[model samples]
Target chain A: MKLDEFHLERIQSQWENIVDYNLSESGVEPLRLNELVPHNRLQREILETKLGYPQTNGSIPLRRNVSSLYEGATEDHVLVTNGGSEANMVSIWNMLHESDDRDEVVVELPNYMQIWGYSRAFGANVKSFWLTEGDGAWLPDIEGLKDMVSKKTNLIALCNPNNPTGATMKEEHLKAIAEIAEDCGAWILSDEIYRGAELVEQRTPTMWDYYDRVLVTSGLSKAYGLPGLRIGWIACKDEDKVRDLWSYSDYTSIAPSMLGDRLGQMALEPAMREFIEKRTKRILKENWAAMEKWLGENEDIMTCIPPEAAPVCLVKYSESIKSTELAESLIQEKSVLVAPGDHFLLPQTIRIGYGHDKKKLVKGLSLTADFLRGEE
Target chain B: MKLDEFHLERIQSQWENIVDYNLSESGVEPLRLNELVPHNRLQREILETKLGYPQTNGSIPLRRNVSSLYEGATEDHVLVTNGGSEANMVSIWNMLHESDDRDEVVVELPNYMQIWGYSRAFGANVKSFWLTEGDGAWLPDIEGLKDMVSKKTNLIALCNPNNPTGATMKEEHLKAIAEIAEDCGAWILSDEIYRGAELVEQRTPTMWDYYDRVLVTSGLSKAYGLPGLRIGWIACKDEDKVRDLWSYSDYTSIAPSMLGDRLGQMALEPAMREFIEKRTKRILKENWAAMEKWLGENEDIMTCIPPEAAPVCLVKYSESIKSTELAESLIQEKSVLVAPGDHFLLPQTIRIGYGHDKKKLVKGLSLTADFLRGEE
Candidate 1:
């Protein structure tokens, strides 16, 4: 009935018209239309074919592709949604509805805004586990996380290869979090949107592998670079929980776009799988190199905890400038767009995405460097 | 988290395999798609060129076209949604959210299931205003509705040119109901899915003309014969309510399908509008005649209150046969699917849809006649 201002959406709205050079984007250098698979001929054929209503859960082919991404997961365990946003919302709502005493949610701060936004929307008390800059890395305080968990905690939401900070949790840390969740009968909702884009790994071990209560939400948007298609899925081992989420899903979005489902399936094909993996590696390698070079040239004004996986890396600004002011100045003077750290609850940092057009990345970072040096 | 069985989804759900006849269904009395459009290249171009995200509320071009159907309406007053289903859901949720005390919803019984389903999903107390056989026509009793209205009633939902009964509310009666809604400070949600398929007249005046609180939900699915496109819109006179619904719309569905929006715009174009009007008149005229003739031949076994609009009419079965049993028998023996009236809260009746191909209708009716005559 009554809704508070959607904090993240409001921020997005503010930047909607300020398009100059988007240096602040959080995803991998987004794939151009030509970068997508099946070639133009195949895409044309798909567009020409009459697209009927997609299966509300997901197209079987797409679900099968997503299922293969998990070790023991089946098509039955996956529910394709509008996007990762809907996937997260449905999973959280289901978890909250399942336990009345579980009215609180624990999320890692300096994470994606939706993790906290959705938790708050469900009327849950959200406690954020801070990720701090120490020992040359942005690492989560596992002890803080332990303290945040309680008998009333229904969900523990985490973003692996985390947004903005790009902080990733190792298998040991995930297992530790899973143990706490299991003990308290809480579900661990690990947002793996940046899963496949990891710089060094073939794949990250999801929380779902460690605990049946864990729910993994991911989509083709980030790793596969198909945000325009708007296809996402939730993988859960609990059949009852899956069913409950499906029912709630019906009330939210009856079904995902049929065209998107088809494209997602194509993008997940065995051959396409290899293509995306190679593509992600290439993009990450180039972008990270560009970022390292730029940061080296501007060491006096900026420093970053190198990202382990995702294309995004958080760079702390000099004490002379606020992150927002620096970001605004960079945009206005250099026509470069980079996200301010405040969006991720870290005010002293700015998020720079290396994944973009190689030329644009080079040009934008140069402009950013020049702007910082008063050479613009 | 523990969820109730009713809330949990069962694996391999039933809804997916329901044999949606709307897809690829055609017969001798075929609903020819070409008859409605005469092969317009512009429509095809629009569908093909339609890409990228649609406006969150709706595509301005499509919304403008939809607004033209209403007197003094503008694009700002329309909120495009996934379908009539989503439109109805948004309006109901918004209305219930606006006032806490008015948490109950009154809906016309023997109407579409979605009307009540959405109300119940929103935690609204749902009470039905029944349509009984005491009336020569299937009409809502004004007195019954008056008695049903209470201080707690926040919304009232109805379908004009009703789903199962093909009952159309008179303009005077609609005005009276609108007056009651205004007096009680409740919102009126009119499902006008079959708006243009009137048997004789052009169409009834929409409730929107008389009340600022009325929300008219319609789609291209039924009368426009574009169900495959999956496009719908809600028109509200109040700008504040429109804004509120649009804000809620973002969280529910980020946007309607872009391709669907483009197709909807083309479908409402001047030429397409003329085609739809002509095709609707022809189909209803022929279908009504066929139904009348079938009823004339089987007067003793079954009878119907001749419908004024919509493609469906309820025929009362003889007291000897249960409506559900008769419907099941028809489906099993003849492969002619007709909904059991009990699904619409009419136990002694079965809904017969004459919107299918003429030969299918003839065969179906003949099969019914033979069954009644003890031939099958």
Candidate 2:
């Protein structure tokens, strides 16, 4: 029952109240009420029909819809979970048989807490390869990753368009990782929650496309802007892995919520898919532009590796102001909340999200800039 | 991952067809959905509003409403899950930390597959205490239970108004088991999904009332006739256990579905509570009466241990045919589906659920009796 300190939830519980601006979040700009489907009528009808036990795997229609997102995947390959978090947890728990003495897990550092947290929970030996800010961009060192591989390693977890850092691995880099994983005979789990938010024209290629050993995890919470709906899925090419994870998934969530699945299905429709792409393109373009202008205007106070895909970017403060202390001061002084980089093992950096309303993002950044300049 | 064969889903792929009854299930007769809640304009208004991420633990209103069902338990004690299945699984996995050297779990035979399935999945050394037909009433033998308990035992799971058998334990018997659990330092988890479906009483005494080491899990699926809602809860008296499980629960389900929570709250209202009680009482009383009449008329062909609560009973066929074969024949010949007791480790006993419409239950029993009597 004694959990490792690193596995504990590190996000301070107090600042949950900051409203209007939440730059700490990794998900894309969330859906407004009007954007959700059934639209109004469908939601009403579903609610009128008393919510009952949904299908154990997921509603068939929802599963079919999710399966359609991939080229050859079917409902059998898809397992709907509570959210991407559960999807990732179940996949890891099932793939990395925890009780086996030989089981070890490799996770990318400067990543979200979920991968390591669950890894530690299962009593696995988890090693992290640091993704440092080098050559003006954040990326994992190929040698560092190679050094972590071993015969005992059961899985390698990567978050593409990595959270906090917002750095993405190119297709060649992912294929290289896949080759290494195949050599080690380990499952490669790619958390693509932020997959659809690429700022550039080339979307990150899914690991599944390269290796049968890969499992792709994504959900509506991130790129689709529907975190509230709380629907996520895992697509695995291996039938045995699919069945193993499905069993674990049943224990976690007898099935995904029917309402969540329905809404998620609607969100994956051609129209919704195009809407999400457009939204991601619009938000990333505008917000990154705003960030560049803001940083340029106050060059002496802060610096960051510009985000290429996801909504978040990690910025280093000019002086030793302790990221946590500075984040708290920002929230208290200007009601602008950002995640401290210490939570992700990068103490000098702070994670700032750029996926809010244009006007609000501008106002918040200006206030943050003024505060950093000690003018507030 | 080399999972033990014990953890494998007991029913083969063919058994999945039995779940298809949901399409034709009559909510009025078996589940009594109508009396449970009356959808009004105000509730409809709430449904139309976009449901965001519900409280990760559960919605506050919904948790509070669920807490009101228990005497000493509060909202803090309740952890809402996807359904009774998740609640049971969370309790089992968190409580039973099976490692290489020490692992033991004792579960009731003739119980729901989920309880034992999850136990085995955790790689625990699982032992089953029988609820045999020879016992006449399907009660666990205290001496037999004591013989199975050991210092290494970490957990024991049971189903009240036991699934398939539908046997309800008296308060004193439950307390005795709790004492045994206390001596071994084992956590006792009771699945009480059919809590309000007692044939004669307004309410049944729960194991939670007898022991702090006990965790009581239930959901709105069965008695409330709202399985589609997929809302269930785990209430533990131990605060530390609650906290630990809450953390693990987070990895399982970030939160219950907001729509499920909202509808669950409405279903737990004072009016709805009374309505469900009345409906369940009527259905259980009438169904059992019809079943008793059928048993009396065909005493030479079959025998049953009359169920005290819930809507199911284990009926032993005098014919030499295995329960699985009989169940398959019934489904194929009559389009009447009933769960095979083989899933519960009872080979000759067929589980007959009286939760359907009175006429259907009567007709199904008649058909089953005719088939057993070689008159088909």
Which residue pairs in candidate 2 collide?
A51-B228, A51-B229, A52-B227, A52-B228, A52-B229, A53-B227, A53-B228, A53-B229, B30-B355
lDDT of 2 at A274: 90
After superposing candidate 2 on the true structure, give the runs of residues whose Cα lies further than 4 Å from its correct spot: A5-22, A32-34, A38-45, A48-50, A98-102, A280-298, A324-337, A354-376, B4-40, B98-102, B130-136, B328-336, B357-376
Question: In candidate 1, what are the lDDT values of residues B1-376, reduced to their tens digit?
Answer: 3332221112113322442221112111222333433455642453344234455577789999999988889998998887776788678766866666888889987786765765675567998786655566877777788888888888888788787777788888798889888777778888888888788565866887777778899987667766545577899887777877876665555567655676678779888777776776688789778879989988988889987777788888785777667666665565555666766777877777786566667777787778767786
Would you give me the overall lDDT of model 2? 0.73
How many clashing residue pairs are found in candidate 2?
9
i-RMS values of the candidates, in order? Answer: 5.0, 4.3
Model 2 lDDT tens row, B354-375: 7766776778778777778777
Compared with the true structure, what per-residue lDDT tens digits does model 2 show for residues A175-220?
Answer: 8888889888888889988887888788877777788878899888
Which TM-score values does chain B get in all models?
0.89, 0.90
| CA error at residue B289 for candidate 1, angstroms | 5.4
The residue-level lDDT of candidate 2 at B128 comes to 73
Q: Considering every candidate listed, which one attains the maximal DockQ? A: 2
